[model samples]
Target: MTAHVQQLHRVNNLCAGLEWVADCPNRLARKALLQLIGEEVGFVLEGVICASEQKIPGGRPPA
Candidate 1:
């Protein structure tokens, strides 16, 4: 598989795992989720905030 496809799979798996523990309030779990998504996809939600500051017109950030 291509690198992009593999990364997508990893992100999907992370989401599935999080769904299994939907009621937990553990900081570590949340942190891990963000880390996994970032590592696989190149940006977390927090990264989006930083990216918006760049002011790149017509740039749609990755999902």
Candidate 2:
């Protein structure tokens, strides 16, 4: 779990650097940022399900 969070943080930092590159067009940067945001949201949701299943008895986590 710690490793996953660390990887996500690294990805976010890389995305930030890509967003600041002068050669990348505004539209392209926006698209990349949006994709990264989607990935981050998915990660958060997965973490939530994992935590919830551990806390609740007989709770089946989402696939």
Q: Against the true structure, whose TM-score is highest?
A: 2
> Residues 1-63, candidate 1, lDDT per residue (tens digit)?
254455556666767766655655887887776666556445443354445644567766545
Give candidate 2's TM-score: 0.52
lDDT of 2 by residue, 15-49 (tens): 57654654556877767777776677677667756
Candidate 1 TM-score, C-alpha based: 0.38
Give the clashing pairs for model 1: none
Q: What are the runs in model 1 whose C-alpha is more than 4 Å off?
A: 25-63
* TM-scores of the candidates in the order shown: 0.38, 0.52
